[model samples]
Target: MKINEYNVVAIEYSLKDANTNEQLDTNVGGKPLEFITGMGQIIKGLEAEILKMTVGDKADVMVAPADGYGEYNDQAVQVLPKEQFAGIDLVQGMTLYGTSEEGDTVQVTVTNFDDNEVTIDYNHPMAGKTLMFTVSILDAREATDQEMATGVVGGVASGGCCGGGSCGSSGGHSHGHSHGEGECCGGENHKHGGQGHGGCGCH
Candidate 1:
């Protein structure tokens, strides 16, 4: 079937940086990543590309900085008082979590530190990098009514709630579902069909 909104898609992908030719992510020895189209479960550029493909198709796409994570912003860098990190040992390249001015917890990397100042950068790690996606569509199918209703494709039985205070199997992985406002793989909650914040580099 043609890939469209609400269709569950399974894909194998190799993500690279266009400029450095460095591989950033890949599906190696792991299950194919699955998600529903136009569901904001995936990045905008990659999702848009998937919509143009059919099951069993493959394509290599180059996503520009603007279409991907956007250009790096210098304003994202800030110097915090050294005392703010009371018990943590500060070091370059260390990732630290703290609340932002807006009250959202954000992940910032320690770029530098001195006796009284700590340089922290909130810019996304790949903010300025062009993303090159080598994508292979493994499978595609129409989602069930229940899957569409809960915004999750696989895992729970029909009429079962897997998220949002609903209880189900905790060990099984649910493919193509929104994480809502819970932590997944130690990362922040990701809303289905919405733009991701700066932490997980998937943005």
Candidate 2:
């Protein structure tokens, strides 16, 4: 069937930095990445291209930074007292997780630090770079009523792709979750995966 809004689709893809040609993430020989269409589960640019394909189709899709993770903002950088991250061995260029004032889980990178202060960048690690996703659609089907209601491929608690971290394994987004590196898929309650390449994951 033609892929449509709210359809659950599974894809196997390899993501790369379009300019540098650096492979950022892939699920080639791994589990298929799956999500519901028009639900904001993956980057819009990639999704737009995916909607044009059918099961067993393959394509190379390009996603501008704005449509993916967004452009990097200098204002997103902030210097906080070192005490804010006490006890952890801070490493420059490493991603870290923290809670925002609204209690939302946020991810930041250690850009610079010293004995008294730490400079963190709130921009996603992949921000500002265009991305290329070489994708193969494995499956696509209309979502059931329960799936649509829960915004998951399956009904709530039925353990959709996000629950297994397949869709978000380095790239995809829904809400309250960043797919860069090892960020969790399901939001505040899920455990972050091991740090991988910088990219978005379905979360």
Candidate 3:
């Protein structure tokens, strides 16, 4: 059937950085990436293209940074004095959680460091980079009543593709109770996933 909202579609895709050709994510030899269409379960740019594809279709799609993750925010980067970091051992490429201005937890990545200061960036890891994907739809079908009701894509019975319960993974958002097969936060509002990669299990 043609892909549509509330439909489940499985795709075998390899995601890469458009500039550096770095593989960012993939689900080909493993559980094929699946989501419910019409739902914002993935990047907006990719979702728009998936809407027009049919099963067995193949395409190499590119998404701008704004449409994929987003542009890096300079304001999000803060170089704090060495004194700001205490107790924790600092590393060059480690991710650490910090409380935001509003008391929300934000993940910060250690980007650079000096003797008296450390630079951490709170931007989404993929921010500022274009994404490219080689995709082939493996399967597509209408979602089940329960699946649609729950807004979940690959559940236990579907041999869950994204093993992580949190789709937010390394993104700026949190999965709540979701793994990589992200659902709406708390699975309450599956309509919008979040900032960049949003949605429930709607492929």
Best by lDDT: 2
**Candidate 1 on 1-203: residue-level lDDT in tens?**
67999887888778788899987767645666666665555656777888999888999988886666557777777776788666666657665553343444454567888999878766655667788888888899987887677666674423221111111111232222333311221122222112322332101
Candidate scoring better on TM-score of 1 and 3 = 1
- Looking at candidate 3, the ten consecutive residues that score lowest on lDDT are 194-203
Q: Which stretches of candidate 3 lie over 4 Å from their true place?
A: 79-90, 97-106, 113-118, 154-180, 183-203
Write one digit per residue (lDDT tens) for candidate 3, span 70-103. 6777766667777666555766766555444443
lDDT of each: 0.58, 0.63, 0.60
Q: Estimate each model's TM-score.
A: 0.68, 0.75, 0.68
Question: Distance (Å) between predicted and true CA of 150, model 2?
Answer: 2.4
Residue 193, model 2: lDDT of 25
Q: Which should have the higher lDDT, number 2 or number 3?
A: 2
User: lDDT rank, highest first?
Assistant: 2, 3, 1
* Residue 25, candidate 2: C-alpha displacement in angstroms: 0.7
RMSD (Å) of each candidate, 1 decimal: 8.8, 7.7, 7.3
| Model 2: pairs clashing at backbone N, Cα or C within 3 Å | 168-202, 170-200, 171-200, 171-201, 171-202, 172-200, 172-201, 172-202, 179-201
